[model samples]
Target: MRAAILQSSTGIDPLLSARNMVEAVERAAGEGADMLFTPEMSNLLDRDKARAAGSIVAEADDVVLAATREAAAKAGLWVHIGSLAVKADRGTAPYANRGFVIDDTGDIRARYDKIHLFDVDLPTGESWRESNSYVPGDRVVAVDTPWGRLGLSVCYDLRFPDLYFALSDAGATMLAIPAAFTVPTGRAHWHVLQRARAIESAAFVIAAAQVGHHADGRDTFGHSLVIDPWGDVLLDMGEETGLGYAEIDPAKIDEARGRIPVLAHRRALGAVEVAR
Candidate 1:
């Protein structure tokens, strides 16, 4: 199947932000993509800690979801939203950093709350405390589609290689790493991390990401990419407001695994060690 990965930018206006997403998806659909994936926080790129916390809401009533659902139905394609700020429960907070898979029929097949929270201080003096605003998910999730079993994950989860291995062991053929990676980290680690996962797990890796500056003056390192099981870059969206496409063959997963046999050759280490 053909897939499209969107490298999107944050806009000054929320509605316009949503429009950019719709237009990108539409363009991808017009190009005959069976599936289309958008980056994290596809709606607005508000980086102000206070505003992002207050503004991002996870709800079925979210405009971006509604529009994407409509677009998916109209385009007759499966649309995977990398991540969106969703309002979780009312009377408490605004939302969660969530992602969804909408089938061609406009039905939501799967939903995943970002399991790993981004909380850190960068050398750039940019501090992000994702835990302050959103609740983290407690489970690993995968969903079945016409293509194959798809593993779902968001940005910070990239650091945990074990998660990718687990997904592949569970029969996943493709993994999604949707992110709004900070420019520094993205430039330094994004491609290598993605390539490593594909190499280690023998699964196709699809990463859709944000590019350029957002509403709150935060910039994302955007190089949305699709890598094959053999660590080959099938398609790369290098710093642009566009989409990247690649044809995925699920059978390649078996081929890669059969050749490398990395999963079967593993020696297990017992227990986690405490750092003193």
Candidate 2:
């Protein structure tokens, strides 16, 4: 299967981002791509809590989601809309960082709300409290598609290996980690962590990233990467706002697992007593 990864910077406006995404979808379709993957916060990227809360709408009312679904149908390709900041139900939740899988027919096949909220205080004086506005999802999602079984995850979830292991155990052959990572952490841990996940899971890792500076004065590390099951980098769109294409072979999963067999070599850990 051939896939196109979109690496772009999203501003505070969802409408403009939708337009840009549509163009990229068209280009990917022209290049004969079977699917297109985008980055986290593909709709909008604003740090201001009030502005974000006011600007974001429910999934049904989001223009970016509607436009992308139309584009996916028109292009006849699956579209993985990385993640969108959505206003959740009034009483149950404040907001949701949601990811959508749109099929070639413009139908939503799967929806995964990001489970891990980024609550960190970086040494660079950058801090985020994602839990303040968005509620965490308690489920791990893996869905079947024409290409293969896919595992869904978002930005900060990359730091958690257990989630990936659970998805792989659930028969996921490909993992999608769409992110809008900060420059400092992205530069430090992005590639290593992504490659590690691919190696450990023995699955193809497709990470479409948000790159460059946004209208909200936030800088993101943009190196959208596609890694094979064997931990080889297939395509890397470095720090640029564009589309990167890669060919995925499902057979690679079996080959990698056969060589390593780590997934099958599981054993329960026994209790350990303190040395004191």
Predicted model with the maximum lDDT = 2
lDDT of 1 at 11: 57
Q: Superposing every Cα of model 2 onto the true structure, what RMSD results? A: 1.4
**lDDT at 110, model 1:** 92
Model 1 Cα lDDT, one tens digit per residue, 1-276: 899988888654556767776787788889999999888888767766666555555566677888888878988889999988877763343467788999998899998888788999999999998887778877788999999989999999999988887788788889999999999998899999999999998889999998887667888899999999999999888888788899998778889989998878866689999999
At residue 254, give the lDDT of candidate 1: 83
lDDT of each residue in 153-236, candidate 2, tens digit only = 999999999999999988999999999999999989999999999999999999999999889999999999999998999998
Model 1 weakest lDDT span, ten residues long: 86-95
Residue 83, candidate 1: C-alpha displacement in angstroms: 0.6
Among all candidates shown, the one with the greatest TM-score: 2
* Cα distance off (Å), candidate 2, residue 88: 1.7
